[model samples]
Target: MPGFAAHSWSACGYSVQKVYEWLLGSQQRVTWQPFVWNRLSLPKHNFLAWLFGKKRCLTQDRLIKFGVITDGIYYLCGAQQETQAHLFFDCCYSQRCAHLLQHWLGVYWQGDCVYWVIKWRCKSLCKKMIVMAAISGLLYCIWEARNKCKANMVMKRPEAVIEHVQAAIRWRLQRSDFVQQKDSTIAWIRDKRLS
Candidate 1:
């Protein structure tokens, strides 16, 4: 009873926050958190990005490991195994979509797209938020396209996916009053026709 009392009162008092923290332990910061949870990004997009950052998406490779399916071929390109890395970074189909978005945004970086956004050194926080939202939107759209292909045996063109992401980003930007109303930001939004 003494040992139980000591353990229970270790935090001095029982509160939901303390209990929650105690159960979860120390939080490990991740590089992708800022990009994935940007205020400019949609909630669903953030959720998908979080899953992707965690490598928790049910990619074909994981599905195979789980015995959900035997084949691990990527539905997008059909030339590589569908892994979290392959589906998001290495697959030709996804690469094309990423390249198109990168070109449109005029933001270039090497390695994982999420990390690139995180490390981007733009002076404007607004610009960085826009980029993060767009990138998160791209990841969400790519996964959506993959799901469609899997369910209907049809694949959407990279252009179509890019268009969807652009529209979504544009919509979010238009509705966001938090965007910095600087001349450069305005000009950029006008140039991209995202306003």
Candidate 2:
């Protein structure tokens, strides 16, 4: 299982050796410890610039079309100005979702968007994949939820969104081999720490 995890991580541009250390939870823990625990634990170097090999959405480009600058407002959040940073990281609604994730992970919530995604460290390959999927799923769901809330389809609650993310993670993990081995690994990790 660890072997397969290594292969997956390497394929994703991560260092297999570093991943081994991370899986053992022996890596230097990042002090930022935002809303999600261990989601952003990897050093800056390990971060993939593109999410799942897809281009990142640039907010500055969107602003030109929205013409919010001429109108004295931001389109995404209806703020006085629109920028990529504001659209992804600084938006009020997104901040709430980020906060919810931080609380769920039992960690502090920092405001670094790119760093938030880059620092994740998972001991096992399967768990690492699951965590990545959960992060993406959470971000997607929040975006959709925010749009729905803005349109009056429903109200947005960060907790509820987080619940959706957890459900999504469970659904994905059930089909994979990771969950089958979690009980043993948990015990092993615990024992390793004690020794």
Candidate 3:
């Protein structure tokens, strides 16, 4: 067995491969960062919160220690359980965001997870990457907006967040090489009259 010092990194969820990457001076992105220090199943939830500066600036833990459940019954909208999945994907507010995304993509997303639809249905790698970025941005914005609501800040409406998510996705798509071409092709196909 290895010495205590050598084994300590793994205690914090650092794999040998991740440590090697860090030692090799890899540029840090959210996807490449170390796992969080909590035992929470939704590690991605922490990542999304951190990425968008949610629960970062404030001393929320102090408030939490005073016996407060910040997300009691979901402050976003009166939904079921206030879980990360519900807030991010299944909530009424989140479903509105998802509907905006669906309309923007011109496709129906049947699955629950964002990555599944992007990987399985996105026709091209570029579109898939764009969708992944869109998902990230939407999740980040939702967290930020949720935090604002928690702190009683001037927050935009949930519908506005859905519009923002759609706009961001469209902006990314516009920067892609094939978005215009794909749009033109679809329009042409749709507009053609039957003989």
lDDT measured at residue 90 in model 2 versus the true structure, 0 to 100: 79
Output the lDDT of residue 187, model 1.
63
Cα lDDT of model 3 by residue, 1-195, tens digit: 354356577577767786676566766454312222122113354376454333242324334555764544556775564556666777778777766766655556665645453245545545454455555666766777777876795656766775665555554454555445555533432343212
Model 3: pairs clashing at backbone N, Cα or C within 3 Å: none
Q: What tens digits encode model 1's per-residue C-alpha lDDT throughout 44-158?
A: 9999999988989999889899999999988888898889999897888888989888888888877888887888898989889988998999999999999999999999998
**lDDT scores of the candidates, listed in order:** 0.85, 0.51, 0.54
Better of 1 and 2 by lDDT: 1
Candidate 1 Cα errors over 4 Å, as ranges:
1-4, 7-15, 180-183, 193-195
* True-structure RMSD, every candidate: 2.8, 13.1, 10.0
Q: Decide which is better by lDDT, 2 or 3.
A: 3
TM-score quality measure for candidate 3 = 0.53
For 91-114, candidate 2 gives per-residue lDDT tens digits of 786677767665554345366643
Clash-forming residue pairs, model 1:
none
**TM-scores of the models, in the given order?**
0.88, 0.51, 0.53
The whole-model C-alpha lDDT of candidate 3 against the native structure comes to 0.54
Better of 1 and 2 by TM-score: 1
Residue 31, candidate 1: alpha-carbon lDDT: 85
CA shift of 44, model 1, Å: 1.1
| lDDT at position 9, candidate 3 | 72
